[model samples]
Target: MSQNNAIYKGFKVSAKVRQAPDAFPGGDVVHPRFLATVTITQVSTGMGSQRLLPPEIQQFADAPHAAITLALTSAREAIDGMSTFVKAK
Candidate 1:
């Protein structure tokens, strides 16, 4: 397959418990509290020759900054939805 025809393989979304406070029962604390963290990483094959993408794709090849920005924005939107649901309870 041509290099440009390769799909982005996709990215990884990771989450860690940053902070979780334990519940206190009577005068003793049973569970401990900890903080939570979430991170996202994009994974893709290295850039190939410009000929790989269609003419349209070639246009953005020079603008990696914009591409990354768009990716982050999308990721943020997805994370926001999850956060809202978690907070609802």
Candidate 2:
């Protein structure tokens, strides 16, 4: 089966992207504009599924890979920041 998600820093990240609506009148929809979504959940949560950050939405006009990559980067940064907070206090 194909993998649509990745485990990173003990967090599960799944991505979904939608094609952009038709740019021209009655023209074919293009991927030049995509709505990207990334959901991050802890790998092991004592309490039911715990999400570090709420579902994030990103607008991209590039390839899905680029969008996913950006989403992952944002997730990692958020996770790292959260880790710092937890460790600081």
lDDT of each: 0.34, 0.63
RMSD score of candidate 1 (Å): 19.7
Report model 1's TM-score to 2 decimal places: 0.28
lDDT of 2: 0.63
Clash number for every model? 14, 0
TM-score between candidate 2 and the true structure: 0.62
How many Å off is the CA of 59 in candidate 1?
14
**For model 1, the run of ten residues with the poorest summed lDDT:** 53-62
Candidate 2, pairs of clashing residues: none
